[model samples]
Target chain A: MFSGLSAFPLTPMQHGVVDEVAFIRLIERLADAGVDSIGALGSTGNYAYLTREERARIAQLAEKHAGDIPVIIGISALSTRDVLALAEDAQKAGASAVLLAPMSYQPLSEEEVFGLYETVAHNLSVPLCVYDNPRTTHFEFSDELHGHIAQLPNVGSIKIPGVPAAPDAASVRIERLRTLIPSHITIGISGDPLAAIGMNAGCEAWYSVIGGLFPQTALAITRASQAGDTQQALRLSERLNPLWALFSQHGGSLRVIATAAELQGLAASPCLPLPLQGLDKKGRQNLARVLDELSLT
Target chain B: MFSGLSAFPLTPMQHGVVDEVAFIRLIERLADAGVDSIGALGSTGNYAYLTREERARIAQLAEKHAGDIPVIIGISALSTRDVLALAEDAQKAGASAVLLAPMSYQPLSEEEVFGLYETVAHNLSVPLCVYDNPRTTHFEFSDELHGHIAQLPNVGSIKIPGVPAAPDAASVRIERLRTLIPSHITIGISGDPLAAIGMNAGCEAWYSVIGGLFPQTALAITRASQAGDTQQALRLSERLNPLWALFSQHGGSLRVIATAAELQGLAASPCLPLPLQGLDKKGRQNLARVLDELSLT
Candidate 1:
């Protein structure tokens, strides 16, 4: 299953269609940086915004450009049937595994949530990673529910979203989760700001959004933290703090990261799907200054 | 353009597919009971759980069986492009208006929310209704934002969800909204339990879920309330309190209403999309007892 630093790339778009060439370039950069895995269509990738056909195309492009790196396609949907459908499509598209999130229109009971993962995992030939991001899904999974899902067949990993404001709390949460879940189930931490703390707390991987844009920086933090070099890891994370601060202020990093990519000329104008505005002038200026300070420009 | 009681039908499902036959029967019942309009693919319709193709097909069914009753199609999507696409399909299917909700994976700012309606309303030939349901969309529109949306060229109405426990508060909210928005832009109240109060408080229409299942009863309440027959309206609503209590307890009436339809032998089963469980045994027993007491079965 997905391990180490997994780059969750932004699905670059042109006129509401996925720009495959730009997407390929993004993936190649991650592969070139020696990132361990690629997660296409993750939340940062705007999985819910894209159409079904566009999603399939983006997964295919990510897989093709990933080379030897494993590609984990995000297969979150409102229904179990749609999740299963996307999982099958991901497997057929050569994805190494599929990430499942409990995205619901209605509030789901604990039993229903478990049924969603168990039913989808039962039908999939590829390994299934439970994506526990309550911020996006609005359905919180208790430690007891997480333990139940981990014991299910074909469930291989869990992508834990760290609490950005409290890195120490994230470390404590991951530590608690590690003890509760099966030993074989890999624990990967997301939330760019807290990745270092999660790694130091014994998370096996970093399922990262910014890594897709700055894989070198993300990889450096993981390598340093994993080698027990806490000082070096702290220094690297401190350098990234300016951008992380903007992410926190905006309540999300999608638009800020997209703006960062555009400002650095890595991609075209930072245009997201309509109704979702990209960074304003103030946000762009703030992001540009941070990128310059980090020597990333 | 829609006024009076508007029936919001449940998109009856057989396995994973929308059961068209059952859907038509549901609409025909509303038309026969003299409902003023029809809103298909609403929240009760499980619009998010359905595919684009299924949604389009359901709109066509609703229009066909609705006869001359104005059909307002629910056109909510995460992306503006998808919302526009669905809106166009709805227009082609002979819809009178389209309902738009600020449905996003990420929480949208007031600017983004306004832009969603402005962009969609720009291209639509029919009227557009702002569907402000924070519980489902998680994107709340302040009174200022609602006024902004109301001023859009093609925006004709706003569907306000009632505060179930406080019908007086729901009525006062509608009265405030009515004064803020254009006189021509009608304010309709949803939340079936409070429909009677909304009607009495001068709301132009009832965008109802239970009305789709029990149209005759819903119409009677509307007619009584609209004629300034407060006592009659209160008596009618009192008769339906048992069912309304269950709806309130569930936080939503979709599953309960679906169960009521099944209990009355309208649909085959009370199936929601996977991951959203149907009523448990206790809920079912409570619902059955209510239906029996109401003489609905």
Candidate 2:
């Protein structure tokens, strides 16, 4: 079973080129901090901006650095054919599993949703995880659709965002999901800075974008949660709350990942692809204040 | 100088491959019907569903069949790099111009929007048109952003959708748009079945998705509009109105184009890439009734 903290590594770029060395270092750093798994080419990783070759290269690097740790490669594309192609590449590159956010724009029917997962599962040699980040995808997978996808051979997990409710309500949803699928199908929660809240609510895994920048802080929270120390996990979450708030602004995940990499002296520039602008003056000031409070600088 | 009707032909697919013969035939048919110009791989043509090679082949086929008619290739992709590559291919395929949509899913800032068009203009050898279809793109190009893009070299036209208001209001927006840019930059309006409404409102061109399926009807409307016979144009539009309604249901443009191609016997099946299911029994029945009413079957 996949449990504990998982880090979605931010893809590094310099002068419009993928920074392989920086990426390797970032993966290694997360692995050293006891991150249970690594996610590459996710929303936080700017998967839309990377070429197919670049994506494969990053997946290979992630696998090499992760060692025994599982690597969940994000296969988010606007077209199903491209998603299947990416899934095949990720599996060949040694990824442990593939996570998919089907069709970023346009609402899809239940049949379409089922077809998407079925195609990916058929094309991929490894297990598949469903990514239900509705905020970006614009289409939510209904409970009925989820149950149908769960019956597929390779679908083993669901990555749900932690927003829209508290742990108790989230726990209820997880229970509902559990009843629909087999016990082997894990429920993973994303979007909560306080990883313990999700873990306590019966989530088998937690994926964090902030974890890439602050591995030790994230690990501490995860360890506290695993040990059933609710107070300690909450305390860590409170301490890191300001940083999370800063990163949750305009294109927050992208900005946070880039800023954090810069703080670590890894990426040469905090450049995001077109349509996602970098931090403005006020944003930079806010980030500075957060960094100072965290003693990260 | 662009006026009257424009046609965006379907990229024919046969046996899971791009059917270049059918695609060329479709374009030639449109050109013979006196279409002012031809647009390939727009939303009406399922632009996102195609591979790079497939898209390139379709563009080349359009140019080949277009002969003396201007062929404007659609360069729509999630990444700036991919879109630029498409623009370069379009130029090589003998396209007279290219149209670009903004980044998919990720909302861009005004500055980022300008940057995208600026990059395209600087690198692209052919004249570039900015396509503003907020319905599909999910983000509207601000008047300010449009102004900045128009100032860039080689930026030639603006393609605005006809919905959310009537032709008069759209014409007013274009008039205001013209003040901020060079007079050489023409404004084209898409989404109206009748060509006269947009043409009378000062738009230089009218792009019709329905035209590919009904070239004779589209030609009649175009000829009537160009000759200043508004009554005849309106009559033809009324006949075409029911067909437009059939095409506008459930996933709209993509479904419409696919269905139209199938109706014309251009392709054996209407295939949609993953996450977009084929039309249901009710949809097919509705389309059949409309086609029968219009004597298009």
The per-candidate TM-score of the B chain, in the order shown, comes to 0.96, 0.91
Best by DockQ: 1
Which regions of candidate 1 are displaced past 4 Å? Answer: A163-171, B163-171
For candidate 1, the C-alpha RMSD (Å) to the true structure equals 1.6
What is the iRMS for every candidate structure?
A: 1.1, 2.3
Model 2: DockQ score: 0.57
Query: For residues B1-297, could you state the per-residue lDDT of candidate 2 as single tens digits?
Result: 245567877776665567777777788888777777888888767677787888898888888888788988998887777888898888999999888888466566677777788888899888888898876776688777888888899988888776324666756766787788788888777875535576666677777776765667777877876787767776777777776676565655567656656765776575555566556777767776777777751
Q: Tens digits of per-residue lDDT for model 2 on A1-297?
A: 256777888888876778888889889888887788888888888897777888889888999988788999988787777887788789888889888987654467677777778877887778888888776676777777788888898888888877334767767877887888878888887885646677777787878787776777777877887888877877878787787777566555677667656755877665566555667777766776778778641
Give model 2's TM-score versus the native structure.
0.93
| Model 2 ranges with Cα > 4 A deviation | A105-107, A194-196, B164-176, B193-196
What TM value does chain B of candidate 2 have? Answer: 0.91
TM-score attained by model 1: 0.97
Docking class of 1: high
